[model samples]
Target: MKSTLRSELYKALTNKMLYIAIAIGLAFWAMDVMENQEKIKFFDETLQWAVNSGLPIGTGHEGYSLFFLWSGLAPQTKGANLFYTVWPVFAAMAYGWSYSDERRSGVYNQIAARTSAMRYYISKYIAVFVSGGLAVAVPVLLGLLANAMFVPYAQVVQGLGAVTNINFLSELYYTAPWAYGLIWCGVTFLCGGTAACLCFVVGTSLRYSVMVILTPYAMFVAIDALTNSLRASILKNVRLILSPLRLVWSSPGWANPEWWVFLMLALLTIFSFGIGYWQVVKHELA
Candidate 1:
């Protein structure tokens, strides 16, 4: 089982599209960092515009003491925002292809002849999980690197401590490139893995495979569109980036979710894998 799983994993790793998407993400992050001139301008202009226009400088609609800074290069932040937004879909599609192709081409039957369906399914999950993680992380890490260098400019002008406290330890621990990257990547990985597992369930239970793959992502998007303001607090601490990404710019960037939110995320992760495992064990792999 281990050898069979390993071989299957090795095959999944060779996908060119997966690597290409990751490369593009990294390139965008690098470019965003290298060009910080606009980010500074946006930050300055937005704050001034807000104050001049008589809007509260750093508060939410409810008049909560929220510090909202508009960086000149909203595009860079938007890029980071979009990067996390679209990455999970890339992961789901890439990993989904692993099984989709096998099922479509009838290659799965050949594999099932020698290995258990469970082995194949589990192996696919492991391989694709790693791929999804990299899809989210590579670019985020690059962005973090860019922020580490060019971010100083953003801090200096914005009065780094004015909007929010930037303790060196906090940056080192939670807001640092690696730490923030991991948190964001974890969000994408879970979302992607959940999407992939749902696809697998759909593959075995239904004929049309696209529904299983696209439904989860589509559901959240629709909800976000419908519920803009309420979603900010709901998704703010979900650790599920889908929830937060929906309102990232609207809400405070560093909003720490309640502990219960993390617990819920953990539960959801386990539930997704558990469901996938159950389906794999019973799934008819032809």
Candidate 2:
């Protein structure tokens, strides 16, 4: 199991698709950074801007920490919007579709001749999960570091947490901003992993490579649309958004992002693993 996992991870991490996802995610992050040139300019000429712009010099708005990330002051940045909109594609793009190829091409038979099919499938799942998680997580971490280079970690205001749409975990954002940021990173990782796992299942049936890769993104968009429609039509009081895509955005979203998200993600991951294991080991081995 250890050897199988290590081998699969090597291929997954070194895969060109992983890098492509990272590059795409970072490009969106860069768009936000570029769009915020006015704020960056404020950093350069705070004294000059305070006089003319009429905005407070350092009221935590000019460049609060994590400003360039999806969760920062620029909640509706065009690039960030685009990035989150298609993040599931990035997740699944990493290593999710490989399983379909291996199964169809009979590579699994060769692999199973040496190691058990159970070990091979388990390793593949881990590789997909890690690569998928990294595809999204790396860009967010890099975005934070990049934003840190230009902006200071201005303490998130306690009273303004709700005002800024950080209400769900507003206390965490208010007390320890860095921890709050890390929590979002964790969220991104889990969401990405689950998205990829679901795509892996879809890949079982999809023959077209492009559609196999795109399965997760389509599902996220469809589910998010359904959730929105349901919320508007019937479940008006329920503030918790069901779509993971919506949860990826930090600000101006989820006034009550319930604790159940972690539960849902956990169950989804288990279901994917269980189904894959059952399909491969029980039926294929038989």
Candidate 3:
């Protein structure tokens, strides 16, 4: 078990696709930051002008904070949209297709000679989390770091858009901005891992690597299509059930994304792991 787990971890970490996915994610982050450059400059100029004019700056008056500058939390720019919109691609792109590839290449059978198939599958399942989570989370972390250097570390002020926009974790945003950032980082990791595993499950059932890679994104779009129609309706209460894409987003596009909606993804992760285990170990499908 330990050897299989170690082998899986090594493969996951060393996959060229993992770095490719990370680079793609960073590209999205870079575009987001670039598109928001004008806003950043405006805020910077505003703060400088206020300081130069001897204007009393307080709370709502000042805007150069980590929250406002960070690519994920910035206001009004859909710059992060490109990143968040295709996050599933980033998630699964890292290593989700490994199972499908290995199975197709006869590597699974080769490895099965030394270890139980169950252990191999389980180790790959666990390895998926490390690669997928890092692929998605690292870009956000880097964005936070870049923004932190760009601006002074100011707590999210009540009057700012950043504070007001925090719908799910408002308390942490108010009290500990650091915690807010960390929690979001954790959320992104979990979501990415779950998404990758969903694709991993698809790989168990399907032959094509592309199909496995796109399974999560396809399902996400399908769900979004259904829920978006509800947004057109007058039932404000219904909007609380955001699609997985919006659920993972820091700032939900429409109605408030409840923390409870994330449970669906948790359920999905367990289901995929369960079904994959059943197919490979019990049924010997793979």
Candidate 4:
């Protein structure tokens, strides 16, 4: 297992696709920052006005608050939408080709001769999850760091009262800003890793690199559309479970930090891995 993991890790580190994923993430952050420059400027102006008027800067709009440094880069935010939309693709690039490339190059036969299918699959799974997670997390963290350089590092107090609609996770945003930011990064990593693994699993059969890579993104869009259509129904919870946006954004009516949300995510990850393992074991390596 160690050898397999090391080999997989070496491949991941050397993969040009990994660099492409990172580039995509950084590009999204850059675009988002550029688009939200007006908002940042307004925030600076508001702070200046507060100082001139002898009023506390905390009285300004929530949009200008320090919390925006992190929240502004969330998947649901306008500037960050590009990142959210293409994350699955980034994830797909991270691991979708792990098996397909091997199969195509006849490397799987050599690896199969040395290790059990289960060990090989498990190693690839871990590598895919870790690499994919990093691919998604790093760029968002960079964006947050960039945003923080411009915004004041103030507490998110003034924004609390405005949140008349409660999201169970809202307290963290106000009382524990760091944790809130970490949670967003964590979710991005988890979702990105899962998407990559799912694509890799699909690639076990499909073998078509493009189709495998796009599968996760297509599923994400389909789920988003379906959930939006069912917004008024009780199935909204289902929508939340399926939508990565829910993990990043504090929706008006939904109860976030809900145990069920994590539970659902965990189950999805396990199910994807389980299916991938089964596929690998049954597959006839060429």
Candidate 5:
């Protein structure tokens, strides 16, 4: 299993798609930051109010500022919400080609002969998960770092109040911004990795790289549209589960989700992996 994992990792590293995924993620982040600069500046200007209210302005506030910046920028326009609209596509592209590329290059047959189908499938799944997660996480982390460098750090106070979302306004973000950032990044990783695996499942049978890669993004859009059209609060909340952006941002009202939300994400990933594994095992490599 270890050897298989290493071999799969090597293949993922060498694949140009991995780099392309990272590049796309970064490009979206760059565009989001540029588009949202005014919001960041406005937040900075509000620091005087915080100062008047006896708030501390220092490095401790950097994380909170960045968190606030992200929250504000993320929901302003659909285009700014890269976590939902763009990350999944990049993630799908990152691993969508895994099986098809291997099949076309004849590596699938060679690897299949040397290992059990289950082991090969599992190894590739792990590789895809890691590669996809990093592709999404790295760009967001870079954006966070940039915020720390450019945005003024101002402590949270009653006057400045909290960001609308509990996740950003929570004590966790105020007292320990780095840890908060880590948690957000972790959620991003899970969303991206799971999205990639779901694409892989489609790729196993679809055979077309473009369809495999774009399917996840299309599904997200459909869900978003459906949820928007729904009038019931319960259905809207349920649909939030399907939204990677909401999951990561911990959007207003749904912020500080119950443990079941995380469990749902885990189960979804496992279910996708199980389906992909089953399909690959039953597939004819001829």
Candidate 6:
């Protein structure tokens, strides 16, 4: 299993389309930051949209503005949970190509005949996560670097819409803090991995690979829109799509999330892995 997993990881990393797509994403991200240097115009629009979407507009509160800024800007940031879309899309494409092509070429059955099906499944699962992580990490690091050096991090950090006299470290540490940034990035990774794993299951069954690739993303969008239609009171009390990103608004008196929510999510990931393994182990009618 370990050897197979390592080999699969290598194949995933060497995928030509994945490499090209990452290069294109990096180029676009660089251009976006440079053109919007010192102040991204979209930050303000994002803030207004949050207000319109029912984020509380507290007056005379010192923390409210900062809270609003984080809530709004996070969605557009490359490393954020809301941007999990970027990670999963490429992951699904790359993994789908790997899985579907090999099966079509009879390489899958050949491998299964030699290796345990469980090993093959585990190898693919690990490879998919590695591929998804790289898809997210490369562009994210570039965006963070560009934001720190060229773009006015202070303006974005402070929601001020103007560059201020703040060092990059202070902008990063004091404004949002590195700990918070790490958590947000972690959320993005997990969400992306979750979506990719789900899509891997679909790819094993779907006729058109694109349909499998897009399923997770479509579900997220559909769930997000559905959550928006619910009452604000209900939405705030519950965790839903991008709900962790919405934690910038968790009321002071509200109860902390039950431990069960975390447990349930962990179980979900485990279950998904099992499903992916099962699919690979069974003979397909194709």
Residue pairs in collision within model 3: none
- Show where candidate 3 strays beyond 4 Å: 35-37, 47-61, 74-79, 162-166, 233-236, 253-262
Q: How accurate locally is residue 111 in candidate 4, as Cα lDDT from 0 to 100?
A: 88
Indicate the residue-level lDDT of 244 in model 5. Answer: 47
TM-scores of the models, in the order given: 0.64, 0.87, 0.86, 0.85, 0.80, 0.66
Clash list (residue pairs), candidate 6: none
Candidate number with the higher TM-score (2 or 6)? 2
lDDT of each: 0.51, 0.73, 0.75, 0.69, 0.66, 0.53
Highest TM-score among the candidates is held by which one?
2
Give a tens-digit lDDT track for model 6, residues 122-175: 787777766665665566555555555543333233543221222112244345
Q: What's the best-to-worst order under TM-score?
A: 2, 3, 4, 5, 6, 1
Q: Write the per-residue lDDT of candidate 2 for residues 1-286, one digit (tens) a residue.
A: 9999999999999989999999999998887667555465656576566758886655455233443233442255677777777889999999888898788888888998899988898899989999999998888777766667655556655554432443446567666777777777877787788888876566357777678888878877888898888888788887665776665655545553436667668877987787787788888843
- Candidate 2 deviant stretches above 4 angstroms: 42-74, 162-168, 255-258
The candidate, 3 or 4, that scores higher on lDDT is 3
Q: State the TM-score for model 4.
A: 0.85
lDDT per residue as tens, model 5, 1-286: 8899999989876788888888876776666666556556665568667777788874244434555556432444333565455667777787656776676678888888888777888898988888777777777777667556665555545335343344433566656656767777777787778777777556445666788888767776776577656626656455234454455554444444546457756876887787776677876553
Task: Please tell me which predicted candidate would have the highest lDDT against the true structure.
Answer: 3
Better of 3 and 5 by TM-score: 3
Superposed model 6: Cα runs more than 4 Å off? 38-73, 76-87, 152-176, 231-268, 282-286
Flag the better candidate by TM-score, 1 or 2. Answer: 2
Tell me the spans in candidate 4 whose CA falls farther than 4 Å from its real position: 46-63, 72-77, 158-169, 233-241, 244-253, 284-286
